[model samples]
Target: MPKMVFIETDGTRREVDAPLGLSILEVARRHDIDLEGACEGSLACSTCHVVVAPEWYDLLPDAQEDEEDMLDLAFGLTKTSRLGCQIRITPELDGLTVKLPGAK
Candidate 1:
């Protein structure tokens, strides 16, 4: 089984099982992480924004224009920021790590 880590704003690290094919937002939600997918993974909101660890960022597929646009509205966006709904879990991303953005 694949696994990933989510770092909270308060520096807590949560490692959880990451089912293949599910979006990061889905995984977060399942584990009771605080990511708010306000758009229900419809790519209509930036509430699920997350910062990918630099080492894992390039492993992810490039975000689509719509996701990029939504990310622009994310609080505390960073060079590795990505919309959680835009990133799907895959074998290649087994050890993925992302940080929750600071609250707005």
Candidate 2:
């Protein structure tokens, strides 16, 4: 199992042991973490935007042009930002940490 940390906009943090290959969005939704998936992981909405904790940013693949474009519309954009649906969990991301931006 891969472990992931989610820091909510209200400052609440939760840890979950996720199955491999699950998207970050999937993990969040499974734990009822309140992440909005307006586009249902279709790469059409910025509601699922989240910031990868600095230390773990390099652990995931870079965002693609579509994800990047969507991220540009997200609130509280940061250098470590990524679309949760675009990040597939892997063993290397066992300790991944992410911050949920204030909802738009």
Candidate 3:
């Protein structure tokens, strides 16, 4: 199993196991973290927006155009901003870190 660290808006960090292939959003929701995937994993919304750690951001696959369009609506977009739903936990991301943007 892979693992990941989540940095909350208040600066708290929590680490959790991420089953291979599960999206960051799933791990957050499973652990009761504050992220809100309002559209489930449908990619229809940007409610699961997260800022990937700079070092880890490059390891993720490029975002699709649709996800990019939705990211445009994210509350605090950044160079590493991504839809948590679109990032799967692969072996390369065993210790991934991402920060949850402050609440809208």
lDDT score for residue 91 of model 3:
100
Local distance difference test, per candidate? 0.93, 0.90, 0.93
Superpose all Cα atoms of candidate 3 onto the true structure and report the RMSD in Å to 1 decimal. 1.7
Candidate 2: stretches off by over 4 Å = none
Pull out the clashing pairs in model 2: none
TM-score against truth, every candidate: 0.96, 0.95, 0.96
Q: Candidate 2 lDDT, tens digit per residue, 1-51?
A: 779999988888889987899899999999999888899999999998998
Q: Across residues 1-104, which tens digit of lDDT does each residue of candidate 1 receive?
A: 89999998889998999999999999999999999999999988899999999999999999989999999998898999999998999999999999999722
Backbone clashes for every candidate come to 0, 0, 0
Model 1's TM-score against the true structure: 0.96
Lowest lDDT 10-residue stretch of candidate 1: 95-104
- lDDT for model 1, please: 0.93
Least well predicted 10-residue stretch by lDDT in candidate 2:
95-104
State the TM-score for model 3. Answer: 0.96
Q: What lDDT does candidate 3 reach at residue 81?
A: 98
Question: Residue by residue across 1-104, what tens digits does model 3's lDDT show?
Answer: 88899999888988999999889999998899999999998989999999999999999999999999999999989999999999999999999999999722
